[model samples]
Target: MAQSTEAIFIPHHVDEAFEVSYAEAAPDFGPLARDRIPVRSMAAGDLVALVEIDSRITGRKRVKYFERKLQDALSESDVRVSLVAELDGVAVGFIMARVDLGEFGRVDTTAVLDTIGVHPDYQHRGVGQALISQLLMNLGTLRVENLRTEVDWNDRVLLGYLDRCGFRPSQQLCFDRSLG
Candidate 1:
């Protein structure tokens, strides 16, 4: 018997937005079992799982921060995109980002990757990559031309991951100052 699958493509209303959902047969990832991994659009109820994942990775709780970000992302779907990866029905990874129609007067759309986290136990098992891949796919459907992320210079692991995911240094520089 053949297996059944479904794909959904959701359309965004913003300018140049593309459809971002489709159904497909189950993917065979060679030795990497694909059936156990699932990525989907993030919902408001996923906040608790996101917070737990971030807490496990950072060794501290920042519930308020995630609450605000999640609320913003959920409330603004046209400009924001967020995804979650699940393993056996439990969220193991997530990526959050938003689309900027123009920055610094440039007319091209750009995606800003705000936060990504993977539970430590799932770090090297393709959870993070799965989350990012879904994000990129969604952004592509939205006709976003570029993706940007900022990382502390000391974060070698994240930098390496971003590099492996095809992110390169941009010509523009990022400047920041503490209000305090």
Candidate 2:
């Protein structure tokens, strides 16, 4: 793992059939399923299925809005969103991320994992892990300085996963509310 003098190992994850050349990243990766689930970086064709899954799971489905947003994000160079884990070629899980090569405050540049979600029925399986790993791989390919995610303080499962994936507590938090 000898990197150049300025080369830094940015924390990232992968979500699909990661090439074995990056076996070391395997620790942060997981199988989508044992021959049952097929992991993939989603494409435009999956719009319908993803919408259906959302409606069935959360009862709050907005297909066209999301489709437009996805299309816009992909059209942008600074944002790199990778959709993951489609069982039977149907969209079941996804990871959305952004890769920015601009400094936040003092640091140079970074990639941030914005959102990741799997259908509730598909929970407990490794779909989420696979999605995460895949996103990290994408970030690595871009030479991102680091990968970051904003987590709800109460999401213990997510917190544990991020810890296992080698993220540290880089900042603290404060909450605010506005009332009329």
Candidate 3:
């Protein structure tokens, strides 16, 4: 896939705002070993696998959601950062992410971790870690400054996993207003 060539700009006043760079703040974890499972970029052919894995995890099939996610990953963004994990030739996990060249008035290059899912049978394995490791490596090459994700407050399992991956609470608080 082609990459964007636009110059990403960061506000000069960020330091005065006490903003922390995700790249510098993240703890240095040792290199990941990809010997066990093979992680690769998402492809148009893997749509079925992604849908299947997600369905098994959430206990319902959200076909349209996964379809749109896959489409966005493959065509909507300038960069393709989403990934899939396979074992014995079958897809067992997936992580879909996108790069934001800038948002609001700030122009820092950041990646948003949109959706991640591992088949029920593959939970507790190193599949998630491998996916995350590969993602970090990819982001580093593109000079992405940070990775951000949102999790429901009640999702203790996911929160614990993110903590283990060295992700801490973001400095900015998120506020949402319901339109309903």
Write down the TM-score of every candidate: 0.78, 0.66, 0.82
Q: Please report how far candidate 3 places residue 100 from its true position, in Å.
A: 0.6
- Residue-pair clashes per candidate: 6, 7, 0
Q: What lDDT does candidate 3 reach at residue 14? A: 73
Q: Residue pairs in steric clash, candidate 1?
A: 6-23, 7-22, 7-23, 8-21, 8-22, 9-21
Q: Which ten-residue region of model 1 has the weakest summed lDDT? A: 26-35
Candidate 2, which ten residues in sequence have the lowest lDDT sum?
1-10
Sort order, TM-score high to low: 3, 1, 2
Best by lDDT: 3
Pairs in clash, predicted candidate 3: none
The predictions' CA RMSDs to the true structure, in order, are 11.8, 8.6, 11.1
Order of models, best lDDT first: 3, 1, 2
C-alpha RMSD between model 1 and the true structure: 11.8
Whole-structure CA lDDT of model 3: 0.84
* lDDT digits (tens) for residues 9-48 of candidate 1: 4545545655443224432222132224688888989989
Q: What is the C-alpha lDDT of each candidate?
A: 0.78, 0.65, 0.84
Point out the worst 10-residue segment of candidate 3 by lDDT: 24-33
Residues 33-133, model 3: lDDT tens digits = 34477899999999899989988988888889888989999999999999999999999999999999998677999999999999989888888888888
Q: Please give, for residues 28-122, the per-residue lDDT of candidate 2 as tens digits.
A: 46333323556565567767766766676568887876687567557764555566687765567877666667653545567767656678888
